[model samples]
Target chain A: SQTIHQWPATLVQPVGSPLSLECTVEGTSNPNLYWYRQAAGRGLQLLFYSVGIGQISSEVPQNLSASRPQDRQFILSSKKLLLSDSGFYLCASTGGHTEAFFGQGTRLTVV
Target chain B: GESVGLHLPTLSVQEGDNSIINCAYSNSASDYFIWYKQESGKGPQFIIDIRSNMDKRQGQRVTVLLNKTVKHLSLQIAATQPGDSAVYFCAADNQAGTALIFGKGTTLSVSS
Candidate 1:
């Protein structure tokens, strides 16, 4: 199936609020998953990626952290959101050296 | 630092014409490259890809050309249509070779 499920297609939270965005993949084992943030009218910024459970890499140091608790589940979290955290957040998974599959994405707004 | 950038932010073409979108990568070591098309409020979808070992690759109506020497890449669309209007981005494996990186993207407007 190779499907990715990302919830809360749109979110509005206040600054300093906790944030959690979840993504789960189906039909693949040990797939590489990624979290990307895209600002309005800008390119995608790779925030975090996980090759396997408990093996996460941070591409950019920010207010966000990612955890891969299960082989097919990846989570993006923020203890305290910042206004700058607002952006279009996407979850993706791929087989190495192949095209990555993406979820619908969550549009977050920090007010 | 590794970076992928586009030469133009916007490109316009008339229906039935051909369109070319260009990208440049900073890391010469990057071998895997791909092109993606993103519509408004939608996730980017894979269009085509080429490896550094090859100079060109083609899909249904799209072609990807890679120039390892110049560190350049381009996507050519044959017979552009208004339905093809979207933002096109180029991606390459980063220096770490663990994740793919993306460029700012070029908006291709195909007028009918």
Candidate 2:
């Protein structure tokens, strides 16, 4: 029974403000973590993924960055938020051979 | 460039009818495929998965079919209910087991 927890379920941040979204996994260790953004009616856009601590692979060049501070903790951050940065942020983890499990997701609105 | 795409952006089905959603991928190297369901304001939930070695896999009320030759995948929902109304996405694993490449998604609207 693995569970993923993501916080600030919803956030309204001003433009150019800093952003920090955290995701953590329980019941598993050394899992693969991923960060994705989904826009209205669009597909998920992979932002970052980490296979281990201190290792992050960014898929797109954008205003966001990711960090794996612990084996099961992943953080998505941004120094400044843009209007285009508003979307549903999802945190997912996989055991490498099974289906990935997703968190409740964070709905971020940059106004 | 490797990408996953859906054949349709939206679909409306009558309740109790069967629904079929289709997807296509560009990467033949992908060995795993998955289907996800996302309701409004919720994260995508895993529905079913199929490996490239198998052509089809079944879940409680859903079925996933993979056609490796054509690089296509499909999700079938039997006796669709209103609860089944959601955006469905198909994803493929890039073989490294590092990440999943997701498709644009198809919104299924089940009307009573």
Query: For model 2 chain A, where is the 10-residue window of minimal lDDT?
Result: A94-103
Model 1, docking class = medium
TM-score of chain A of 1: 0.98
- Cα lDDT over the full model 2: 0.93
Which DockQ values do the candidates obtain, in the order shown?
A: 0.79, 0.82
For candidate 1, the per-residue lDDT at A100 reads: 84
Q: lDDT tens string, model 1, A24-61? A: 99978889999999998899999999999999999998
lDDT tens per residue, model 2, A1-111: 679999989999999999999999998999999999999889998889999999999888999999999999999999999999999999999987578899999999999
